[model samples]
Target: MRKNLFHNLALTLSLASSSFLASYPTRSNAEGIMSSSPITVVVAEFINESDANWWKEKYKSSFKNMLTNALSNTGNFTILEEDEEAIDRMTKKRSLGIIPGFGGSKKEDDSLQAKYIIKGYLSEYTENEISESTQVDFGAFGGGRMKQMFGKMGMNASPGGTQKSIKEVDLTFNVVVINPRTKVRAFTRTIQGSAKEEFLSEDVDMGFVKSQKKVENKFPIKRAVMQAMEESGKYLNCVLYLQDDCIDEMDAKEAARQAGNDAMDLF
Candidate 1:
């Protein structure tokens, strides 16, 4: 009877351990293996015009090409080439409701034949000028008495103030991502930075004289956009799905390490 009870207990514990291990999520290689699938993604047209007058239409094509190339480099998804007529037909069918959209219906998930779709908006791209100013006051006072009988020379005091200006460029970018099937937002992020320019002005006795500096292409705006996109890509891959498991594992490892240290403290 004692042996049988011990055997049952051991079996139960073994089974429980197996169940826990099976349920624990392993690190995913989906990102590394994205290229092996027949997934077709539609890179939506981006709207790059932010302020009405400052539109650079050439940037629209440049941005689109950059995005396409970046996504292809991930080796996870096969981007539909521009010349694929079948993809065009599929796009039209989905648009006309002849076939369900890429993310529309679970029932059509197998039939739609595409794993995922990507859509984005270049919500904001603008350059702003920021300036800081400071003021300082200068004064001189002098008084002298020459002769004992008569105070000869005397001088009054006068104070004057001057102001100076410093200017910098502030760039901003906002991005958004959506799941094509459910029309739900998957990720969003913003990037902003300020860059200082060389100031040529100096304070003079007649106030201050400075030349108007032209805004050169400093690439701060492009750098901010690229950073935002990179962040969005990481969020899409690991944050949305695997973050919880990774966090739990980290917590468990930390706890075990602490417990081991506490035990060793007794020595």
Candidate 2:
């Protein structure tokens, strides 16, 4: 009788579990209810239309890869690399029977379908350097009492003190989000990043030989572009996920940027 009672209890629990699972057929766990699979997106190669003379075509792929990494960090989309030439080659191979298909199907039916496409264009990229030289004159007639004391000792000279160079880099990208089904550009915006670095060097002047070698300031182009791509990813995530808080914050930042620009325009 004890064994029978245990069997009956097991059967009852099984039936209850089955009923609960049937009622929620789409999910088997609580976590499944909170999140869904990431949406698939294709990121196209970035185009460089900027005024920078050093921009190369191969850098477009690098920019696309950076953007891909940025979007992947958001954990919202399954990013796919878009390559038209590779796709064309694959298609030709498949037609020539070099690539096999499942179930003898001639066409690729289980291919990846993207819900959205991201396009980027480098609209503006510039690097500017400003350098200033400082010197001290110790001429007796031209300078102060301190200069007169130094001049009396035969030290009448204009010695170069320091040279300061400030280099600034600005990068801007125009990003567009397109709906694959509707073929419409759903969102278009510009993302920008700027970086500046200051360098100081002493100008040494020996009596016989003068040597002033100016070291090139390594502009942080990758840093600026990566930051811009990160912002683009977050903005895309906000729009794609319909996150109100992120959207509000982005809007507020844009408004503040515009206000600051307007304020600068007064000068």
lDDT of each: 0.48, 0.73
Candidate 2 is scored at a TM of 0.68
RMSD of each: 14.9, 7.2
Worst 10 residues of 1 by lDDT: 149-158
Per-residue lDDT of candidate 1, residues 1-267 (tens digit) = 999999999999999999998887565643432333534555554565355244476766555555666666655445654423443444454545554545455544333454344444565444555444443322221322222212222211111223333444444444455444444566554433344444333333322332233333443455555655554444334333344454455456447746865897899
Candidate number achieving the greatest lDDT relative to the actual structure: 2
Look at candidate 1 and tell me the lDDT of residue 213.
31
TM-score of every model versus the real structure: 0.43, 0.68
Tens-place lDDT digits, model 2, residues 1-267: 999999999999999999997887563453343236787777888888888887888988898998899888878788755486533433344445442344333333222346667889999888999999887555544447766665575554555577898888998899998765455698887888888888888765533445566666678787888889989988887777545567789888778867876997899
Residue 147, model 2: Cα distance from true site in angstroms: 13
Can you give the lDDT of residue 135 in candidate 1? 33
Relative to the unseen true structure, what is the Cα RMSD of model 1?
A: 14.9
